[model samples]
Target: MQAEGGLRERKKRETRAALAEAALRLALEKGPDHVTVEEIAEAADVSVRTFFNYFPHKEHAILGRNPEHLERALERMRTAPPEESPLTTMWFIVHDVLRDLENEGELSRRGELIMGSPNLLYQLMMASFDDERQLTAALAARMGEPESAVRPALIVSTAGAACRVAMELHKNAPGRPVRELVDEGFQLLAQGIDPAFGPNQSNQKGHS
Candidate 1:
């Protein structure tokens, strides 16, 4: 029964991934406005009912945010070792999220899709804001600080920027290992940026 249950869960994940990929591919090819749920279902070789079972709305399928992935990251953060600083915890969580996204291979096309669709752009922006809010709350709780605390907010912003810039750079240079780029970003955060970039330094001191 356990094996059977595991297989069932695996199939569900596969179906969800198929539907998301089909939705994005169709949206990119024919534009999101023109793509219908039925068409997406057909593209993924699933019934409309099955697509509805996986996603409540078509836009969600296109956006392809996996609840399971987010949950796993949250769980990791919640159970993180006492010695691990919030930033290190965030690094692992972000790496896990990136690994999942990289497996789906959607990050590269996401930029083009968002740029072409105004609605999607707005949806993406709102979704990012919500994600950050959730992470901030989680980090604040973990640190025994209020949500308004500046330390948690600052760390979340810095970590979030690292991941976003890494994704953007990876989208442009597909050959570069995204994890390496992300590491470089985090390293700069850990060991302060170039002195020239410091606010107190001369503006004309350097170019990086």
Candidate 2:
């Protein structure tokens, strides 16, 4: 029974992935405004009803929330030894997410499409803010405080800023790993930002 249940869940995940990929590809080929849920469903070899079951709308298919990713990261933080700082734990979580995204060959293409579309960029940023809220809540839970607590809020916000800097710098640089850029951002934060942003820093690293 457990095996069957697992299989069923796996199939559902597969279907969702298929639909998401198809939706993004179509949005890239045709503008997101031009693509319909039916088209995305058909491309993924699923019925329109199935697509609705997976996602309420076409945008959800393209910009889906990754709750499972957050859950796994939180589980890791919960089990981590107390010696690890919250910043380090947060970096591990962020790095895992970047690694997962980098493994997808279509990530670069998706980034390009998002960059080209202002509306998509807005939607993406809003979704990102939502993710940050969720991350802050998890961090607070780990710290045994309310999500509104200043410490967790500041920590998560700083972490989010570091991630943004890393992602922006690494987005178009095909040769540099996102993790390296992320670590560099964190290092800058640790070493006083003014010194790290000096001209020497720019000359020291190969961007592409």
Candidate 3:
């Protein structure tokens, strides 16, 4: 029973990934406003009803921000080891997505599409803002701090800024793995940026 359940879940994930990839590819080929749900469904070899089963709308597939994934991410962060610092815990969770996106060339194309479409840009911004709030609350509870505390807010926001910079760099130079840059960003962040990079600390390691 457990094996059958696991296989069923895997098949669902595969179908979801196929739909998301098709949606984004079509959105890039046609303008974001021009693509239809039926077209995306056809591209994924699925019915319109199946597309709706995975996503309420076309934009959700294109942006890859479904509620299930978001909730799982927040839960992972919230239940992270007590001994691990928030940044360390976050890196493991986020790096998996970055690595997968980079492998699939998903990040660069999504970045391009989002920048070209005002509607997508605004939607992404609003969604990100909402996600940050939920993540902040989750992290706060894990840390035993009030949700309004500056530290939790800073952790989520700073991690977000680092991801944006990493994506831009990845888009510009596809050869360099995004993880190298993101790792550097987080390392600098873990050191609080000043002490490790102070004028007195002269010796430097070569860039990744």
Candidate 4:
């Protein structure tokens, strides 16, 4: 019974991956607005009904990878040693995942496609914040702390900002590795903003 269940789960995952890949390929070839659900189903070698069973719509197929990536990152964070700081553990795991995306030759294409489509870009941005909230909650639970913990929120927000910065850097420096961009962002954060902005003094007159 266990073996059969495992096999069934594996098959479902494979089918889902196939469907997502097919949708992305069709979108890239014909433009996202031109592709139909039936066409995506045909590209994945599945029926329209089967495609719907895996993904409710074409956009979901394209955007589902983000939640999947976040889940994997959460799993890594859960298993990491207790001695590791949450930020460090998350950074290491996320960096590895981004590196894998780069090595698969999918990052550039995926990034370009998302950036080109306003709808897709909006969807991704919303999903990213949702993932950040989920990660923060998961980390709080794993640490046996309350979700309202300031540290968790700070870590999540800072990490998210770093990711955004890294993505922008990647857009400008396509030849550079994502890890390098991430490291540079973290380094800047570590150096503190005070050096760039000066201390607490303000230049505004009559503001105090």
Higher-scoring candidate on lDDT, 3 or 4: 3
Q: Among all windows of ten consecutive residues in candidate 3, which has the lowest summed lDDT?
A: 199-208
108-205 per-residue lDDT for model 4 (tens digits)? 67677776788887877777788878888888887788999988877777877887677767777889866788887777666664575734456553
Q: After superposition, how far is residue 13 of candidate 4 from its true place, in Å?
A: 2.3
Q: After superposition on all CA atoms, how large is the RMSD of candidate 2?
A: 7.2
lDDT of 4 at 30: 92
Assess the local accuracy of residue 41 in candidate 2 as a C-alpha lDDT between 0 and 100. 92
What candidate 4 gets wrong by more than 4 Å, as runs, is 64-68, 142-145, 193-200, 203-208
Give the alpha carbon lDDT tens digit for every residue of 1-208 in model 2: 9999999999998898899899888998889889999899999999999998888778767764455676877787777678887788887887777766667565566666666677777787777787768778877888899878998787777877887665566666757765787798877666667753567667767563
Candidate 3 local lDDT, 1-208, one digit each (tens): 9999999989988899899899998998888899999999999999999999998888878886656646777878977878999988778767766766767778778976776688887787788889889988988989999998999889888887787777677777768666887898898889887654554334443332
Q: Candidate 4's C-alpha lDDT? A: 0.78
TM values, all candidates: 0.80, 0.81, 0.81, 0.83
In angstroms, give how far residue 15 of model 2 lies from its true place.
Answer: 0.6
Candidates sorted by TM-score, descending order? 4, 2, 3, 1
Looking at model 2, residue 92 earns an lDDT score of 83
Give model 3's TM-score versus the native structure.
0.81
RMSD of 1: 4.4
Position 178, candidate 1: lDDT = 74
Give model 2's TM-score versus the native structure: 0.81
Better of 2 and 3 by lDDT: 3
- lDDT for position 101 in model 3: 70
